[model samples]
Target: MTNQIPAENTLSIEEVQAAFAKSYGGLVGQLTLQNLSLEKQVQSLQSRLSDVEEIAFGLKRDNANLIKSQVTLEAEIAALIKAGPTADQIAAQGKAVIDYEDTETIASFAAANYGKEKAAPVEAA
Candidate 1:
């Protein structure tokens, strides 16, 4: 059972096509605008991602340098521990012995020079 439209009620093929074209054009214009907006959003996200990647790379490089420095410092500490203190360091720990005459001479010199200033030389005319 096929239903048939009356000739008076039926639309012409050209009218239907014109209506479809108008609808299709409107939809296409909307889709085009949406596509452009999405593209811009994607580009903005890509730019932000690039900046984040650069920051991450710098942080990774800095972390590597810090780790290397830490390793170098640890090695130096280990070497110093194995080598032990120098002779000068050991000698510095010993008791210092000062002679009585040297102490008296230093005391006398300081007492003599205390509050005394050298006289300025006369300027030539």
Candidate 2:
């Protein structure tokens, strides 16, 4: 007689495998949902990174423009210094440009700025 296991004491291997498959299916579904959530988070982070990069690029451009403006202003100031009397000097001396050919205007300016005793005598041409 061959040794035989009682059918009630042992479960069929197929039934155990089916139970495992059902549990694993649920776990797989949960994992799929978690994966989708993670993907969305990654997309959000990437979008934010792109926005930050754009802002950095704009700031760099603005900084470059400001530097260029500063250099241009410095060069202009240097040229003005080389040219001659600055606004400060002109203001301090109270000097004004007058048309030399306008004798009447020159006479008026001379009379206003200088007393007749110190003013140059006007010559009649």
Name the candidate that leads on TM-score. 1
Please give, for residues 1-125, the per-residue lDDT of candidate 1 as tens digits: 78988899988999999999999999999999999999999999999999999999999999999999999999999888865665343333321212333443444333343422321111110
Off by over 4 Å in 1: 1-3, 83-125
User: Candidate 2 on 4-80: residue-level lDDT in tens?
Assistant: 99889887899889999999999999999999999999999999999999999999999999999999999998998
Over 4 Å off, model 2: 1-9, 81-125
lDDT agreement of model 2 with the native: 0.75
Query: What is the TM-score (0 to 1) of candidate 1?
Result: 0.63
